[model samples]
Target: MNIKQADFVKSAVFERDYPEELEHFEFAFVGRSNVGKSSLINSITNRNKLAKTSKTPGRTQLINYFLVNKEFYFVDLPGYGFAKVPKEMKREWGQTMERYLASPRHKLVFVLLDIRRVPSGEDLDMLEWLDHYGTPFKIIFTKMDKLSNNEKFKALKAIKTKVDFHNDDVFFHSSLNNNGKDEILNYVEACLNGEVE
Candidate 1:
């Protein structure tokens, strides 16, 4: 889809604080802290700095929503698995995410994973939780530019061994090169057109 306009709408900490008009479909992005979730969002939307990117992990503490094309939303769920935050704060973020994921308006969720490293225990747990909830999600391997061909192959193999996924369902992305941007945006367009579930 051509993104004529993409803008940050709001930051909601609870279900009641979410946008009152929920008629549009939403695609949510979730991953561990410093997993390039913000970079990927900015890339796909063709807007640099639309979603705040930071050198610090756990910077995104709220459920940030961005209205895309004035039709649907791209929801940036707070990153998980950041240990620097207080335990109580982590619990609050977890609750906020659970409520957002349970919402019916969520059309799909893109689970980002760093291609350079093995999926952490927290990542695996998130995958299992998504499965338990029967949430539809696709895996996106980020930072592909940092990996060699052999490394990429091994990483994908290791990831598949840990989580069941079809080759077609997984996408390799790089924020620096804008890799996989078109495929993601096209997939979003297809979902918008009722071409994909």
Candidate 2:
């Protein structure tokens, strides 16, 4: 899983206007605000500060694209959930993300969750919607270093019970230690490269 060359592609305010050509199998990361979406990406790609992590929430306003090894595009989408920003602004942001997730044109999605905390209501909502819409997605547990063995198992079990998705699609991950980074990246590359599943 060596990402020889990674580059930031573009940023978009709306999904409809986001690069019309789905030339590559794009991998999009979605989760609540400050759910380590940016940090997870940076850690997984082994690129420090590539995704722009911050202590503050709601900073990622648009959909950002990063090309990986010239094979697949890692799409860093705006995080949804509670934000420190204004209510009106958050509502607009939600709509923007929704359009992208529900898009029939797009292919794969990855739902990121913090390992220590239980799956929140919003997280469940997103998973349910993805299943209802039949979107191909997988779950990635982030920040595993903060959790104990028992806690990690509990989190995984709860997520499995709640998400109405294929069991094989569920994946465990930790971006901080780069555990499961290769598994995730390899899976995405396999899917995008049209290799047999």
Candidate 3:
């Protein structure tokens, strides 16, 4: 997909506050804190600062919506787990995510995982929740540039020991090198075109 225009539309915390443009399908980006959601968004959109990137985890607190090509939205869902925030705030974040996931406007969810780390309990729980709700999702292993070719193989194998996913079922991305950017963008295009579910 050739991105002609990508702009920050709004930040929202509740369904009532979601952009009135529900006609546009929303592809939600969700994952644990510090998993590189913002960086990946910036990379895919070819915008350096479209989504804020931070070294600190949980920097993205609200649901940020970015309009891409004026056709759909790239929804940056709040990162979950290991944000160094209060327990109540974390719980509230989880609740907020649950409410958003139930919306029909949420067409697809990209569940990002750090390739260097084993999938956390929270990560597994997110997958289970999506399965239970029948939400269409794609797994993305980030930070691929941090690993060697052999290490990449081993890491993906280790992840499969827990998730039971096939090689083609997930994507490996690197914001640093822009790896897997084309495949992801193409997938998004297919999704919007009704070629992929």
Candidate 4:
């Protein structure tokens, strides 16, 4: 899982705009706005400014693609559930996300969740949609650095009670401290190597 090279490839706003050649597997990250998606991506790739990080929520409004080691892509889908945007814009975002998720090249999707809060209704809806579509995804609890050890335990327990996923399918991550970075990279490596489904 050594990242020898990583570069921003493009930003796509529609399904037809996606890379023409699907030569490599794709991993996508999706979550509500301001859930640390950009931070986690930058931390994992060891690139300070690869993915744009902003103080404002809903800054990522397009599907951004990053070429990793020239072998695969790390797709950053636009964050959902940002209410500040207009109704029509939100509708368009939802449609665009649905189109990308339907792509067959997506090997794995990391569904990010904020560890400090319970899963919102939008999050639950996403889980259900994934299930209906038979999309393979794993839940990632972000912002772990903000929680104490005991609090982390409690949060994990509460989340697990609500989600029908095994412990192996969940990861607790913190971009600030590089927590869960290695494990995630290893998982991605395994997937790329045909060792994981």
Candidate 5:
């Protein structure tokens, strides 16, 4: 989808005070530190710089919000697991992440996983937590361009064997190549409307 205008809305410590404007549907992107969450957001929105991409892990320490056409909000939540941040900062980040996921505001969260390698400890933990909490979420494996077609198939198959994903639910995407952009957009849009696509 062509984002007419995408702007940083606000970063909230608590979900209640996130943004009073619920007129728009909400969707969030989350994963481990530097798992290409920002890149994925930019790719899907077709905005090369909508969300800041950083080589430095854990650059996004806050719950960054972006509004797309005022129809929905795309949230760039803080990455968990592997931040080289300070001990005190990491503790606070964990707390922030828990609160963010547990809150009902924008209940639909998209957890991005790196397809180049198997899901990490924190990645699996997040998925399990979401499942335990009964939160609505979907897993999108990113960085498909790094793998050959045969390798991609094998990697996807491996992931499925481990995770038990339904057919339409799992996706393969390459942010650089702009693959699966349309499907991701449609999925998020459907979730924003509170309906299964």
Candidate 6:
């Protein structure tokens, strides 16, 4: 769908702090700390700073909400598996994300994975958690601009070997060149329209 107006609604860590518009659907974005979740959101929404892009990995510590087209919500769940953060903080982030996922408003989740790196244990665990909970999710392989076509082919093959996923369930995205942006948005539109599962 076309995102004409994307605005930052609020940052929430708990259910009570979320926007009261329960009628609207919610799409959540989640990934490792340095996997470029913010950049992907900005690129998809065509906003430069809709979600903060930071040089530091673990900057987004709270669940951020953005209203898109004044209709639905883009929930930016905090990044996980940042090595430098305290163990307690990491655990808290995991719990916070689980709490949000448990809510009924969450329609779909876009799980971003860096193309240049192998999916970590946390990444695999997140995918398993989504599967176990029966949450609909799409895997996004981000930072496509960093790899050549041949390198990308091999990287994707390597990742597939480690993580069992269907070709239709994944998208390659690049924030710099806007690669796979349209396909991703189209998939979102399909999901919102109940055209695709």
lDDT of each: 0.88, 0.79, 0.91, 0.87, 0.81, 0.88
**10 residues in a row with least lDDT, candidate 2:** 162-171
Candidates sorted by TM-score, descending order?
A: 3, 6, 4, 1, 5, 2
Among residues 3 or more apart in sequence or in different chains, the pairs in candidate 3 whose N, CA or C atoms overlap within 3 Å are: none
What tens-digit string does per-residue lDDT give for candidate 2 at 32-150? 88888998788767788789998898888788888788767788888877778888888888887888887766568899887666778989888888889998778987887888899
- Backbone clashes for every candidate come to 0, 0, 0, 0, 0, 0
Compose the digit string of candidate 6's lDDT tens values, residues 79-150. 998648899998898888889988777578999999999899999999999999899888999999999999
User: TM per model?
Assistant: 0.95, 0.88, 0.97, 0.95, 0.91, 0.95
Highest TM-score scorer = 3
lDDT of 4: 0.87
State the TM-score for model 6.
Answer: 0.95
Using lDDT, give the best candidate's number.
Answer: 3
Residue pairs clashing in model 4 are none
- Residue-level lDDT tens digits of model 4 in 46-135: 998999999888888899999999888899988888648998998888888888988766557899999987888899999899889899
* RMSD of each predicted structure: 1.3, 2.2, 1.0, 1.3, 1.9, 1.2
Error of 1 at 181 (Å): 0.3
The local distance difference test score of model 1 is 0.88
Cα lDDT, model 6, residue 126: 92
- Scored against the true structure, residue 42 in model 3 reaches a CA lDDT of 96
Pick by TM-score: 3 or 4, better one: 3
Query: Candidate 6: deviation at residue 114, Å?
Result: 0.3
Model 6 alpha-carbon miss at residue 77, Å: 0.5
lDDT for residue 187 in candidate 4, whole number 0-100: 88
